[model samples]
Target: MKLQQLLSFTRKAVDEYQMIETGDKIAVGISGGKDSLTLLYALSGLRRFYPKPFELTAVTVDLGYEKFHTEKIDALCRELGVPYHVIKTDIAHILFEERKESNPCSLCAKMRKGALNEAVKKLGYNKVAYAHHKDDIVETMILSLIFEGRFHSFSPKSYLDRMGLTVIRPMMFVNEADVIGFQRKYDLPVEKSRCPVDGLTKRQYAKELIHQLELDHPGAKQRMFTAILNGRIEGWPVRLTREEVKSSS
Candidate 1:
């Protein structure tokens, strides 16, 4: 039952969003975490018996946690036969030592994403996918609403026009709980890492708070996702006919 749900959710998102095509070579960004591991595994499951011809590769960016290592992840990728690339960057030290900002997670994420985007492009992969899940989309939507004064969420399919790259989140429809459950069911090897501000960050607080809100209102989480799925929250203006837009202009 669990496997069926996971596969259905993934396949629907993939087909509906057109994340990858028959000949597209996709590079997945795996961070040695459950969300990423689940995503890679799901893609593996899809590829094993999939009729279409496509390619999958794994890339992990070493954020230089020192305590955080990549050997285990390397072995996992080897077993999966997913060609892996590890790019090491001193992101932690840079965030802690150079800028010395009290809040480093946000900046560190930006730096890490920039490094990954550049690496994937240089490595000659045309499509790059991340493992952001439903919870992440909800949290990001809430964050944008409260902090950025916008209720926007990142699209399942988005293009980075400046870089000529396509960024995709193939796990957008699945939630964190399901990913964790799958990890436990499959006994996936997840290496532990020590983030400097592990529990002191705002996102951690948001997760806890959101969980509490869901507890208070039983269907809150599902409702939040449904809003996205049905496009109830996106504030994009309605597209108009050429005559209408021309008259407005």
Candidate 2:
């Protein structure tokens, strides 16, 4: 995907949700991964030309993985002149040792989120932005439906209780494929996850299924997004309005 396309996509999501405004202090969550790195770079680029007043600082939650590296992330932020914070927490050890669970992706994610929330509160940021994209939302929706019998997915903009900070997904409209493409185009720094049983998790299975469907039928994934935004609720595990149901039916 071209940089111009990414600009328009990111602008739309931010504009629609009013995520950035005059004098807003936003914290971009950086995990030293492709997604977060791309997000930080995009936001930084937008800042130069954006007609509003907003400040962004990079923040990372270090889970104390044995092979994980924060140096690269630090160098990027430093090069960009963005202030960053490294939260030192031994989440990986807790997930592996205490839990003793073979696959701890879900728990590990929750712990990371909790750490992020706490960090936001401590740092006094008005908004916290994550790198969750369209694919992550789709996979999460499916996972929630199958496992919890719930219709829940992360919103582009929402309020957190403990942190009392607005959580925003500036990349909500971005596709994972596009992100991967951007990574290739821009050559952003990325680190491999140190989680040993990473692909064994159920979410990985969901991701593979979604990937296969996207290959089998082009526009199938886009239609799924359109269906959700268009208010069709059959595919989702949630209550639906009569109008939405009739419109789809």
Candidate 3:
């Protein structure tokens, strides 16, 4: 998708969920991947003319891998005129060397988020923007159902009461395919994930499962996303109708 298209989808989610407020400072969690880079571009572009003024900061937590680097990400942040911060941590070693746990994704994710949240809190940002898109939302719901026997996915906007931080998914309406197109069209500085188990996880399985379901049913993915919107999941924002949106604007 083009930058304008991305901005439209992002702005829709942000407005529907009331994610941003005047004088709000949001930290965009960057993993140097296509999705996150796309989010950075969307938010930076949105910042220019959105009625509610806000600030953007790009942040990436370096997981202490030998080949992990953020030089390109730093340059991109500079180009966007957003401040960039990289928090160096030994999370890689702790996960693979020290603790040596068999199932590391869960623990590693918790550690990484903990580190990111602490750094964001220290930076005085009130909110954090995650890069999860529409596909991710549906895939997560599938994962929860298959593994935990529950029908659930994350909300577009959620509050971490303990940390006093609000998490917002502005790209929730953007598809993963669109994210790839945007990255290629813009030549974003996408970085390869250095994680040892990058694609060999349950999430990957769920993603592939959804792809197959879409192929078989031809509109299954869209139906699932629609279901998610109308499911009344806790903490999910009440979706605004076209009339409501017009009135609000």
Candidate 4:
């Protein structure tokens, strides 16, 4: 997708969920990947003319990997005129060398988010923007169902009361395919992940499963996303009509 298309989808999610407010400072969690970089581009574009004025900062928690560098990301942030911060941590060593975890994605994610949240708080940002998109939402719901025997997916907006932080996924309406297209079209500086278990996780399985389902049954992904929107899942934002959105804006 182009930048304009990305902004439209992002603004839709933000408006529907009321994610941003006047004078709100949001930290975009940058992982140097396509999804995160696409989010940075979307929010940077949205910040220019969205009715509600807000501030944005790009943040990444470096997991102490030798090959994982942020030079390109820093340059991109500079190009976008957003402040960039990298929190250095020994999470890589802890997960791979010391613990040798067979299934490290869960622990790695927790450690990464814990570090990211703390940095965001210290940076005085009240909200954090995650890059989870439509595919991620459906895949997560499928993962929950197949693994935990439940039908659940994360809300577009969630409050972490204990940490005093609000997490918002602004690209909830953007598809993963569109993200890839945006990255390629814009020449996004994507830093490849060096993690050993990058694509061997259950989430990867769910993603592939969804891809196959979509191939067999056209529009399956859209149906699942629609179901999630209408399922009345706990913490989901109430759907707003086009009239309501116009009046509110």
Candidate 5:
């Protein structure tokens, strides 16, 4: 997708959820992947004239991988004029070598998020922008249903009272396919994930299942997204119409 198209979709999500506020400093969690890189670009561009006057800081938590490199990402952040910080941790070794746990994704994710959150808090950021897109939202709900026998997904805007921080997903309206297109078109410095279970995870299974269902039932993805939006799931913010936002502000 083009830059304008990406920003438009991102702004739709932001405005609907009131994700960004005046004088807010947002830390963009850059995982060096396409979704995050796309988010970085989207937020950087949004900060140009978003009217709310928020700041952007790019952060990456390096998971002590042997071959995980982020030189290109560092350059991209410099080019965008966003302050970048990398939190170095031995998470990879802790999960794989020290603990040797069979299911390491859970622990690894917790550690990664913990590190990211603490780093953002120390940097004086009030909110953190995650790159969870529309596809991620539906896939997470599906994963919860099939695995945990529940209907749940992450919210667009969630406040972590414990950390005194807010999590905002500005890319919640952008599709993963569009993110891939944007990365390719813009030549985003996308980096490969060095995780051991990168593709062999429960989430990947849910993603494939969703893809198959979409194939069997065309427009199924769109309908599923609509269901999620209207399902009244807890913490999922209600999307306001343009007129509603205009009048409210």
Candidate 6:
């Protein structure tokens, strides 16, 4: 997964979902992980010649973990020439020390997203890019089915009415394996997640299950991804491209 490969997948998702528009200011949520860093690199490269020029800002909602260091992330952002912001929050302490919730992932995620949305809004960014890839979409769908008894996954593009912000998943077409490869090939400065429950969450379980299923039934992952794209799920419709509109007319 070289930079060109990343850009190709990203552009496909962006074009299919109509995720970007000229003059759009999109903020990339930097979790200091491989996924987010790869996203930053892809988007930074995309900005060079993407027909619909858009600006980007890298943002991270620091959860106030003692071991989390963001200096490398700052340097990466600087090297990419993307402005970065880290919203400091005591979310970890609140979830672990004060509230002491048995299930803290949900609460921590909510707090982090709230902080991120507020920060982006204040920074005047109307759109945010999350690094949810193909695997994440499939795993989420599986999780929903197994846990919630429903088939649902996050959309490639979503508009948060309250926040007046749109969320885009430019990496939706990229595979998690490719993301990992990209990180390694590019030597992305990945900051390890300091969350205590990082790999013990429901999502992590879903990921393992998916991996086993793929091993048992080869090509299962690709089949599932195809199903998701054509499943007619809400907000999954392919936006009409300009060429398609012209041809139809």
Q: What are the Cα lDDT values of the candidates? A: 0.79, 0.80, 0.94, 0.95, 0.92, 0.91
lDDT value for model 2: 0.80
| Candidate 4 segments whose C-alpha is farther than 4 A from its true place | none
Which lDDT tens digits does candidate 4 get at residues 168-231? 9999999999999999999999999989899999999999999999999999999999999999
**Which candidate has the top score in TM-score?**
4
Off by over 4 Å in 2: 232-249
Better of 4 and 5 by lDDT: 4
Would you estimate the TM-scores of all the predictions? 0.89, 0.88, 0.98, 0.99, 0.98, 0.96
Off by over 4 Å in 5: none
User: Which scores better on lDDT, 1 or 4?
Assistant: 4
True-vs-predicted CA distance for residue 175, candidate 3, Å: 0.6
TM-score of 4: 0.99
> Per-residue CA lDDT of candidate 6, range 124-187, in tens?
9999999999999999899988998987888999999999999999998899999999899889
How does candidate 2 fare on TM-score?
0.88
Q: After superposition, how far is residue 108 of candidate 2 from its true place, in Å?
A: 1.4
Ranking by lDDT: 4, 3, 5, 6, 2, 1
**Cα-based lDDT at residue 47, candidate 3:** 100
TM-score of model 3 relative to the true fold? 0.98
Worst 10 residues of 1 by lDDT: 232-241
Candidate 2 vs candidate 4: the lDDT winner is 4
Query: Which runs of model 3 end up more than 4 angstroms from their true locations?
Result: none
Error of 5 at 137 (Å): 0.5
